[model samples]
Target: MGGTDDNSNVRSVKMVFVTVGTTCFDALVEAVDTQEVKEELLKKGYTHLLIQMGRGSYFPKKSAGGSGCLAVNYFTFSSSIADNLKSASLVISHAGSGSIFETLRLGKPLIVVVNEDLMDNHQSELAEELAERKHLFCAYPQTLRSTIVIMNVDALLPYPPADAKPVAKLINRFLGFPDD
Candidate 1:
């Protein structure tokens, strides 16, 4: 299971943690600004705490928070989001296999941010699949502006499946190891 750290250096900002895999291609597409979402988040008094997946992406030096609106791109992960996922109060992330799985396992509320530029719209397909499973919130970039307003960060927690052993085995296989 994934874990979180309630205490972090990012406490000053309203933490909206994000993870987009290593390429940042998904990060670029998913990071598109829907002015409405930005405005709504600002109105709600939130400062965006972005944890981008790319180590090379451009991050702003300062942020405006809920006042003027600034996107502070914080840390990037070379491996998994398991560590940073704990620090987030809300997560806006790419709809990738690893990210979605970790989000569900962590029981954290997730906003399915799809990457349009990659894999023949596979991300959208995956988002739809996960949404069908009642795992988390899903929205297109266009709708994300409005959707963020109605999102209840607390309402997205998923109950772990009873048949968790198979899931655990699958994860072990994915991690390239035999189940213990």
Candidate 2:
């Protein structure tokens, strides 16, 4: 189940997608420093995108690209790229619950950088637990360079866990909506 897929679009490049979740982390100013990480990833042949999903953040009109990396910042979720999680061969992200769940569900190899000073450090704690369990890769901003080197998107794939179904019935369980 763990092997490179040449036919898979993921093997073709390295990509980073960020999800800030529903809350804002002022400490995310640290991400401006991602320029350094971007340089290193490009040297290793990867493209980077930074999506900002916070109240006061703004998506850049221009793309963030340099040193062979391409990055984009968005203030809100773009439906066009929602499936980017599923299609990306590798994902670099913030340690948000929603982000982690979606990445794991898609079976993509992930390098999660936590949002500092938010939620009693819960995100960091969660990232650590998951990393120890072999569920995902985790790192802090300073160590990002070394972490990226160890990643092989091919090593993460074909998730073995059966997709979970709901444990309880819906409140309006009987009606199936028509396709519009």
Candidate 3:
């Protein structure tokens, strides 16, 4: 993703939240903190990037040779992330099912980055399923920045709106209610 292009897109993206859950996801954080990625995001007009840097050892402020553009960005670990979820224009996250479900509940466009190093590639399964359903996009940390740039958030759309009729009917049937 080359830096310097559209102004409207920049104006459109006001806040982007990148979360690695409560685990160490240095790779994903590092990808976003890369000079190239920083420049690309700046060019795209995404000024506010709040990173939930979990247990990662790398600190953006202490990183060497990083552009000052990232200096003003927000970085912290917060367990109660509902506020961030509510405010973010887009969410880029680890492919944890909890995060996926909650983000979808908020109706935000999510990009899932699956960590293959973890035990059992189950998150990959969930990520792939959601990606196929057009509910989210998936990428490895290695390709995260490019994936973000290449995929237009507007086109990706929010998760399909929730429908409760089927669930309600099933619950009522289980309780011995007459079939409608």
Candidate 4:
């Protein structure tokens, strides 16, 4: 594990995981499914692209399991995406706090795509703040390609790990269970 490898068997797969959470973000799904995005990701040394499409009506038709150079796969939902996030070398996610912070806590490079069609769109504020701090890159569906082209994962600042104790205690009280 410590040695450098020039062989395929010794190399770990570099996967790029995309998630839209439980909301429908078809624009985002469509944006990354394009040939250009896939090629760009390959050029950036990523070996696979996995998308969690959420409840979006649009499903990616291009490359599923059998693709050239870059393998692309997508799904509507999953019981747990913690494993996916942990396995990913890079993450492209919706501007949802859960998705954003989860990836951030994993110390993975992240690109947050904002759903501008949403009514309030307060998620953009959070994305913008994180982007300002150099923790992640922010993009809209239209700018995803350009953002991908220019994104430098090495430049991102690592997000500090979050404390779950307070939240856990609050939930425990609400459920009438003693705090652990």
Cα lDDT, all candidates: 0.64, 0.60, 0.73, 0.86
- Off-target runs (Cα >4 Å) in candidate 1 are 1-13, 26-35, 53-61, 64-71, 157-180
- lDDT for residue 122 in candidate 2, whole number 0-100: 61
Give the Cα error of residue 73 in candidate 3, in Å.
3.7
- RMSD from true fold, candidate 2: 9.2
Highest lDDT among the candidates is held by which one? 4
Clashes of each: 1, 1, 2, 0
List model 1 lDDT by residue over 104-126, tens digit each.
Answer: 77777788877666656656776
In model 4, the Cα lDDT at residue 101 comes to 79
Q: Candidate 4's residue-wise lDDT over 40-123, tens digit each? A: 888788888899999999988645433346778889889999999999999999987768877888899999999999987767
Compared with the true structure, model 2 gives a TM-score of: 0.64
**Number of the top TM-score candidate:** 4
lDDT ranking, high to low: 4, 3, 1, 2
- Candidate 2 vs candidate 3: the lDDT winner is 3
Q: On residues 1-180, what C-alpha lDDT tens digit does candidate 2 reach at each position?
A: 678765644335456565555666434424433566556666666665555555535434446555355655555545454577866656767776557766787777787887665656766876887787677788875677777777665655443455311201121132332322
Candidate 2 residue pairs in clash (backbone atoms < 3 Å): 64-71
Instruction: Extract clashing residue pairs from model 3.
Output: 10-44, 10-45
Residue-wise C-alpha lDDT for candidate 3, range 19-98, written one tens digit per residue: 98898888888887777876666666666677888888877543222233533354667759899999987788987666
